[model samples]
Target: MTERIRHDGIVVVGAGLAGLTAALAAAPARVLVLTEAPLNAGCSSAWAQGGMAAALSPDDAPELHAADTVAAGAGLVNAAMARLLAEEGPAAVRALADLGAPFDRTESGAFAQSLEAAHGKARVARVKGDQAGRAIMEAVSVAVLAAPHVQVRTGAKLTGLLQEESGRIRGVLALIDGRPVEITARAVVLATGGVGGLYAITTTPAELKGEGLGLAALAGARIADPEFVQFHPTAIDIARDPAPLATEALRGEGAVLVNADGERFMDRYHPAGELAPRDVVARAIHAEREAGRGAFLDAREAAGKHFPDEFPTVFAACLSGGVDPRKQPIPVTPACHYHMGGIATDADGATSLPGLFAAGECASTGVHGANRLASNSLLEAAVFGARAGRAAATQNDAKGPFTAVTAAELPPVALQALREAMSRDAGVIRDAAGLTRLLDLIDALEAAHGRSAPLVAARLVAACALARRESRGGHFRADFPGRAEPVRTVVTLPALERPGLRFAAE
Candidate 1:
């Protein structure tokens, strides 16, 4: 059976920093915001530890920020978007502060700044060390709930997008309280975060499995650099399934990376050592683990006295693992964290399909290319989220009387196996053999599970990873150890033909 539900104005999915920004920008445009979880619970924005990167300090400039972004991107960023984000980031940060975000400021009332992995200057504006995400989301959520024109619905999970015969996106299909329903809106924006959930050990909430990217691709939107997945180097290696993150900011504060033998090893990988780019650092840690060296973040010697106030979350996580940060190094491992690729969008967050837009970690606006620079994710979300919302609100359309489709059924056990396959094979490490094997398994699972949302997300990730042959940034290949000439690997759904699992010799 099929059911239809109609909504007026712009429809925003995900309710994170980007979604809230979109709602605020679309004010007086009458927005309907939907979230899968209670607004602040599972969204990645609230889990962000490092703060927004902007040219807020007197010694910093947007051009410097842009250059750092380009360097981290490994030569794949759109110069225009990088410039725009850098130039406009300060104003956005200021606006959030005005909305009561309570950003940490210096004694002189200037925004306090810190440096992360690839940034050249102390340009990251934070709040109380690692409380930026919680603080920012708290401020945004208050404004969103108080807004007269925004209606937010909790427990609304997106199943797919609704598109017309002409290939234009009209609205979305959602699972509201377990009942499938269709929503026709004037415009639709996807702020559904990233694909961190696809991994067995990740820093993102378990519900976000590249759903936004799959929806956009199925709707015939261009998908860019779907192979680029950023792995944060130091997730606390505890018994937790989705491991707790040890923020990169700790390294910026001089925490050292040591082996089980208490010897610092990052020095051999890069001269900057603990201060190297995330991809390099992650690989070093992975190599250590592979060699049975056992990696650990020795924060005790440096920030032990400041653990409770400086990094409460990390302190608590270490406590849960039966290790006190005040006395010992925490067991660490590289965990899948952020996705640098997603549904392709322009500077204003418009996709090729009319009435459809994307922002935040789910949209590839060329700000983060092969690898995203640390702390830039939040900046991109606020900057582009506002643009997306304003553009979507101004757009007008009447989706003809909505028609719903019967969803294909699936068997439960088959679905679990598919999730396991994706987590194991397409995870942090990859090579031609594993990817090919994973694609074959995905084909089998799709045949059994049918073309549901989860299957779609899995297939797209596997296919795109298979198609991108070179090793770059987060997409590492043991076989191909260096980056090939950089070009965005753009993909389109339904145009792909799954070749049988076989790899020719290089």
Candidate 2:
């Protein structure tokens, strides 16, 4: 039995930074926000500890920011997209301020800046060291509630996308309080976050298992760069299911990466050592743990005395876990943090299918390329989220000949086993045999349980990683540890097949 609910306004899914920003920006037009969690609870935007990146300092500029962004992208970055993010980032930060976001300021009343890896200058705008994400979301949530044009409904889980026969997306099918309902709208924006939850050791919210990316692809949208999953180098390893992050700002402040014996080890892996690119640092930490050396982030000498004042979040996390940063080095490991690829979108957040726009971690706009520059995720969400909002508001697709859609069922599989498989075979490092084994498991799961969203999303990543045969960015291949031609991997549901991979069923 299916129930239809018609909404004449733009429908935005996932009430994170992007969705909230879009709802506020789509002024004069009615907006409906459907979220799986209250406000920012399950959204990655609220989990971000590092501040947004922008060329706000007197010594920095957009070109410098774009240059560093290109360098970190490892050859696949689109120069134009990178330039746009750098150019619009400053104004976006100021706009957040106008919305009452309390950004930290220097003694001179200018926005304070801090340096991160791969950046040439000090230009990350923060708030109370690591409270930037929480502060910004608090301000944005207040604004969303006050906006007369927006209506928010929390705890709505998306199941499918509604698309007309003419390739125009109408709205979505969701489960609200466990009852299936179809909500049709003039336009739909997928701002759902990343696939970090697919791995057992992750820094993202556990429920973000690439639902938006999978649902969009199932509806025939093009997926881009699905293989590139960036692992943050230093997640606090205290046996927590979803690990707490040790922000990269600690490295920027001169913290060292050492082993169980307190010997600094990053220098042997890269010339830049602690300040190396994220992929390099993650790989180094992975290597250390693999060799039975154990790994820790020694922030005692760097931000120890200033712990509470400089990084209250990390301080509190450590204190709760019974580790004192001022006295001892914190145990750390590489954990799945962000996905650099998702449903492919253009500059204005338009997907290949009409009337569907995307922003934030769910959309791959080619700005992050092979690897993301540190602290750029928040900026991308705000700048592009607003753009997608305005574009969706003017959509005339409301006149569409809408189609009847059936909701996809959750696949029955061993969830814990699947996550352990991904972490063992697909985390930090990879090889052909491991990826092939992963695909074989996926093939059997799909064959027996039908195509589930989480399985489809995981298969998209593993299959693409197998096809990409060389090491690049976060998708490292131990068998082919080198770079190839810089072509981005783009695919649809039908195109993501592994004809060459073979494995015996368990």
Q: Pick the candidate with the highest lDDT.
A: 2
Clashes of 1: 0
| lDDT by residue for model 2 (1-506), tens | 66788888899998889989999999888999999799869988998998999999888999999999999999888899999999999999999999999999978989988889899998899888888999999999999999999999887888888888987899998888788789988899999999987888999898888888888888888999988999999999988878989998999999999999999999999999999999999999999998999999999989978998999999988888899999999999999999999999998889989989999999999999889999999999999999999999998746657764443455435556667778878889999899889988878776766777878789888988888878998889999998888889888877765455432211
Name the TM-score of candidate 2. 0.97
Predicted structure 2: lDDT: 0.88
Cα lDDT, model 1, residue 94: 98
lDDT of each: 0.85, 0.88
Residue 116 of model 1: what lDDT? 89
Worst 10 residues of 1 by lDDT: 497-506
- Lowest lDDT sum, 10 consecutive residues, model 2, at 497-506
**Residue-level lDDT for 212 in candidate 1:** 79
Per-candidate alpha-carbon RMSD to the true structure: 2.4, 2.8
Candidate 1 positional error at 262, Å: 0.6
Give the local distance difference test score of model 1. 0.85
- Residue-by-residue lDDT tens digits, candidate 1, 408-475: 44365665576567656776678778877877876777676676655666666777777677777777
